[model samples]
Target: MKRREAREKAVQTLFQLDRTEMSIDEAITYIIESPIDPFYERLVKGTVNHKEEIDKTLEDKLEHWSLERLPKIERTVLRLAVYELLFEDEIPHSVVLNEAVELCKRFGDEKSGRFVNGVLSKFEQK
Candidate 1:
């Protein structure tokens, strides 16, 4: 499983959390058992554990955009990328940014990729 595929699953997992309010364990089980690749499992675990901080960071960085205003998919993708950039030092910031752009292109609206890129660029500047 490539990182982008894992990121896709992570985005879906985050989106589902809004509706299901499932426990992390349950979420992990669901993601692992589902078609989502094992490589993304770590991302799912990391995102769930630190969602509040991640969300807060996103909100902080996106000065003009409220977290609630963004689409769920876009928000989830951004959250995953932001988490990697802030917490996953092993992965370069550029990798996180590029993968995030790819995810936006695939899963988001027409402007999503650019929006994600701009937000993450702001994150990197800090």
Candidate 2:
């Protein structure tokens, strides 16, 4: 699968982790056992490892928006994108933002795609 698709899978799994309250080990094991690409597994693990920092960066960029107040899907998408933007130099910022917008359209609330785009755009400008 493509890296973008892999990222989407990671976002979905992270969102699942929030709902299921699965320990990192459990979530990692479940993802490993699934049909996900190995690249995706790596991305998911990296994001989870750096989630605290990523979320904090996200919170700072979002001004009044608390990470907790975001819908789970939107939160996960932002986490995944920010992780990529901050850590994965192989991927361009534009790619991360585009993939996040697509994932929001697919998995988030109706207004969420645009909301995500707006937030991510601000991050890109910095």
Candidate 3:
């Protein structure tokens, strides 16, 4: 799968996991209709594995918004982008940022793309 598609899948899977109590594997299976790619698996697992730390980093960067208060789509997009920014060194930061903004535009509210861009810019500084 293309990295963008993988990122989309990862966001969907992560969003499902966030709303439910499903395990990562279960969440992936539940959402994915086709065979899974390694990149897809990696994004979901990596984001989930480091979620506590990622959330802490996000909470620090958010202006007045708690992570929980953010919409699910925005939160999921941020989690996936933050995972790539912090852990996946093979991908460029700009690419990660752009993809995140795209995901927000596609899935989140009207302001979500800018909100994601602003929040992720803070993470890039660290």
User: Largest lDDT belongs to which candidate?
Assistant: 3
| Structure candidate 2, residue pairs in collision | none
Per candidate, the number of residue pairs that clash is 0, 0, 0
Ranking by lDDT: 3, 2, 1
Task: Summarize candidate 2's per-residue lDDT along 1-126 as a digit string, tens digits.
Answer: 887677766876787787577886677666556565788887788888898899888888896889889888888888888888888888878877888888888887658988888888877533
Clashes of 2: 0
What digit string (tens of lDDT, one per residue) describes model 1 on residues 1-126?
777767877777777776576976677667657664656777887887788999898988886789989888788888888888877888888888889888888888669988888889986532
Q: Pick the candidate with the highest TM-score.
A: 3
| CA lDDT scores, all candidates in order | 0.80, 0.80, 0.90
What's the lDDT for candidate 1? 0.80
TM-score, per-candidate, Cα-based: 0.85, 0.85, 0.93
Please give the lDDT score at residue 19 for candidate 3.
66
For every candidate structure, what is the RMSD over all alpha carbons to the true structure, in angstroms? 2.4, 2.3, 1.5
Report the candidate with higher lDDT, 1 versus 3: 3
TM-score of 1: 0.85
Error of 3 at 118 (Å): 0.5
